[model samples]
Target: MDKDLNSIVQKALLGDKKALESVVEEVKDLIYNLSLKMLLFPEDAQDATQEILVRIITHLSTFQGKSTFKTWVYKVATNYLLTEKSKKDRKAKEVSFDEYANQIDTGQSAMIRYTNNEGEIGLLEEEVKVSCTHGLLHCLNPANRLIYVLGDVLDLNSKEAAEILEITPSSFRKQLSRSRERIKNFLTAKCGLVNPNNSCRCKRKIDFLIDSKMIDPHALRFANHTKRSIDMMQKIEFLDKTLSVFRSVPIIGAPNGIMKEVRQTINSITF
Candidate 1:
């Protein structure tokens, strides 16, 4: 931790509103991106962002600063999100998949293909765009998405994120793997972008853009496999026997019930 970080946190903990705001600004992107990836919806991401900051304010006094300030801050955010996830219903009504699909029409696809280079900075076309949302971020589920955001976007290692989320490193790896598998399958199947087998580079992405058709077989297979897998995973006898490690411990930051009020909350808080 930088020496000055301690001072900032100390002031924030003491209710210096500016100090608290500064802290919020410092970690805003991390919180927003993590929320976006985990919830896979724009509105949810916005809500999570606001809720996280409010949580930080509520818990600021309790922050002991034992570890790096960033880690400690993240730990608080993770705990708050986990608490929200365990709830039965959400503040915002859950959006049906049908409603979401209706928004991502083919005309939007043509626009995105020509405009956003999938949000990669240098890869953006000659004319830049104001990103309306994390369009691709919503492609994740609660389980696997965190790992991708923490590891890939934020550049945090598995161990650090695990520490923040309070899960074992191995569980982190498994979740990350599952998250990647699901996303890779989704991109290939849904948007028809990304072919993992053909080459390491994203040549397959172009194929999807050019062909304008869904050619991914795994999407069909996944649709079939998901139901049985969920049922099988729920059966204590088998799920416990196989997923012994991930089963026993409390899921430090299980998904936030993947909610809807999520949008309202984010819009309220994010700077």
Candidate 2:
């Protein structure tokens, strides 16, 4: 933790109610996004974020200052997500890039309703990008999925990622490299976002997505409303379009009302 945040933690520990709430607010987005990516559904992510916050509150005093507070929070988070992963049946069907493309291609004639609202359309486009990229992450197993998210999407360094995962830097790097190559190769081969030669694009698939009920314009949940459209298309070199596509999607923000709900939950707890 930085000295300022460390001071906040000291105040929080001293039974300052506002300071404790500040601690929850400080890490809220980090925990929420981590759960969002790990769980792959907004409702599940919200639940996980609340649960993780409660765990943090329960164990806050045990934080020994051995690692930055952010790192420790992530450690608590990853452990919770891992345990959640283990409780489920491990076999999530892997959708190949080709399979995903074909699904869109075969469903094109299903009568997608075009909206006159440009903003809604743009939000839909962004929704597809984020959902697809997050789906790609899900194609990896839980461990590699978390590793790739930490090292690549979140841009944590090797030491920081290893600390969150409780692994040596070498091990984290190894998993991240393999995960990256696997995703890159998959996207390059089948995703039109990377290879212009391929026959899929977000605009072209909007019809199929609507027909399939994969996107609802009024209920768009993943599009980042705060940023401008131009900011969404991150520029990578033409040759590195796969990475560019991954980079282009904006970070999904927490839903409205979650922060207040979290604060209330934390305050209600005896701990």
Candidate 3:
């Protein structure tokens, strides 16, 4: 795919209209998924994806071929995400892992006693599970969060991920280890999905999540999409079974009308 993308990128740099559109089509989903994991909000992810695509198109001429086109795209996208001030403001709302865990435990007692008349509690449970896990990721600062997303969620190797982040391989491995251990320790102590003995269950938290407006039953985000099964994940011997919860998230696609919007942006560009 990178070989074909590199050829198309070359044509795109030379001002081929179809090649530009193909470039957008090929990388839109990748950018959107990465953005979604980073932002944890679908709307924010959509906006970031559009901006990143525009940056990629405008900077197409800067490609030096030192890396594959896909890796270059990741580098561009990660740079935008890392430095965006608005995104930094969003991260400001993040809570510490201990605070988040305490909230979950406390909320379990305040949970409204409601009945699942619509028979949708199952879906609601899934939403709570996904939302809580995504929220947990916010405990990490942006840099560490990016590392976790790249290494664990996206399954990028340390060397490849280091190149994208422009860090040494050893630094990347060390940071990834720290991030993974932090998450592993938290999940082991709190998440019932990761440890059956843990008291926190998704079903038990749904009422509180809904009552607190943490999740909207009417507007289901992550749960409504098709999720990747655990079996589909790469067989990495070192990956703990508990961490599969993050890898099993649904891969969100670019929003409708994105292609049209991207094409308009491309047409407006001089090259």
Top candidate, metric TM-score = 3
* Cα TM-score per model: 0.51, 0.86, 0.90
The TM-score of candidate 2 is 0.86
lDDT of each: 0.47, 0.74, 0.81
After TM-score superposition, the amount by which residue 181's alpha carbon in candidate 1 deviates from its true location, in angstroms, is 3.4
The lDDT of model 3 is: 0.81
Clashing pairs in 1: 40-138, 43-263, 46-266, 47-262, 47-265, 47-266, 85-256, 92-260, 92-261
Error of 3 at 248 (Å): 0.7
Worst 10 residues of 1 by lDDT: 124-133
Candidate 2 error regions (>4 Å): 85-98, 104-113, 224-231, 235-239, 269-271
Candidate 1 wrong stretches, greater than 4 Å: 1-3, 85-140, 185-271
Alpha carbon RMSD to native, model 1? 14.0
Clashes of each: 9, 1, 0
Candidate 3 per-residue lDDT, tens place, 197-264, comes to 98887778877777888788888887777452333334534347556778776676788767777788
Measured by lDDT, the strongest candidate is: 3
Residue 259 of model 3 has an lDDT of 74
TM-score for candidate 3, residues paired by index: 0.90
